[model samples]
Target: MQRDALSLSQYIVYRNGVPAGARGGLRNMFHRAFGAATFAGFWRHWNPIFGYVLGRYIYSPLQRVVPRPLALILTFVVCGAVHDLVTMAVRGAPAFFFVPWFVLLGTGVVLGRAVGLDLSGRPWVARAAANLAYVLACLAITLAGECFIW
Candidate 1:
């Protein structure tokens, strides 16, 4: 299934669900590929491996070992850092990209715990609502920070 991309910027503007930012296809592809490659490098450095051993041995069971919420938070934090680093490399504004993305990830984790996946295996509607709320809350926090800080 094709998943919709969440728009961190839109969430702040709408005070509703996350919105997708407009981007050229090529640019979006490059950004996604760069982000993926960076994160892959980080993953390899953190947990070195290769081949079927990598997927089956290293990754598969790792998720089961940790609580879902903790894992989600950690993964998003790492992803945010990867995205921030890529943005810095491409745009030369490291701190600006880094701070917002890092904060966004942290916000996502807190929101997830507070809403998304927190309900006890409820209906799909409930889960989706929670996730939507989580995204909105994160954006709100980001906007608040931007307003007060700069």
Candidate 2:
């Protein structure tokens, strides 16, 4: 209750000091379909908790109708589309790399989650690997944006 501090809704949950609401650890609901780690991390990392709406409202329901793989793909597609629209609006031109960027992320989510689910008796490896993969994915997307987004 400090001054200038606003309270978060009860829906907000924390994981390892990071704000990844609603049981978003390695075994959280998001991990099952979205990926074991970092997929939801995009929003979770942001302090305002923007990812909450996307994961809870959009992602949750989408998973019910679509196949798991398709749901996974859709998740990134939604993310990409939103980003693309934002880029178009702000920059007044379509950078358009977000589609492929998010697609690549969806691929990483599937592969990383599969591997992370069972790290051959070493969970830390999966965590570290996932973190590394997320970092690399971000770097790749950023580089692509720099080159393509004019």
Candidate 3:
């Protein structure tokens, strides 16, 4: 069976689940992501544009061959590689920040899901703080790993 593909605009609207007038603005994205009650939900809300492409082209395909968790990690690593590539081009030097960072975040998602970690019962402020803490902790760990590597 053939699947119907949505245009980027439609995908953004569908992914964000926002009214057409809202257009998934940056502020809305930030609110949804940071306020998400689960790490997976945060990813679902983060950067709908990139998520659409990665979900459709990378993770979906890989999941058919590998396990879902592996696919998720690979998708994140691919995204980080793309970001690193752009940073390298602009800086005229190699950069290796995003890959490990994304890997840790992806792992967090998988483990968090495995543990049934959900903050939905918490206040919105608490949920947002937890999500932000997860992100910053990943960044700090990645920086430490990079320091060891260099």
Query: TM-score ranking from best to worst?
Result: 3, 2, 1
RMSD of 1: 13.2
- The C-alpha RMSD of each candidate to the native structure, in angstroms, is 13.2, 8.5, 2.8
TM-score: model 3 vs. ground truth: 0.90
Error of model 1, residue 24, in angstroms = 22
lDDT tens digits by residue: candidate 3, 1-150:
121277767866665667444854777888888999999999987888888788889998999999999999999999999999999999999999999999999999999999999999998899999999999999999999988999
Error of 2 at 10 (Å): 2.4
Candidate 2: regions farther than 4 A off:
1-8, 13-48, 117-130, 138-150
Give the C-alpha miss distance for residue 86 in model 2, angstroms: 1.0
CA lDDT of each prediction against the hidden true structure? 0.43, 0.57, 0.88
> Which candidate number would show the highest lDDT if scored against the true structure?
3
Q: Give the per-residue lDDT digits (tens) of candidate 1, residues 6-100.
A: 23343222221222343443343333322322223222222112212333433344557886555544555555566668878888874444456
Best by TM-score: 3
Backbone collision count in every prediction?
Answer: 0, 1, 0
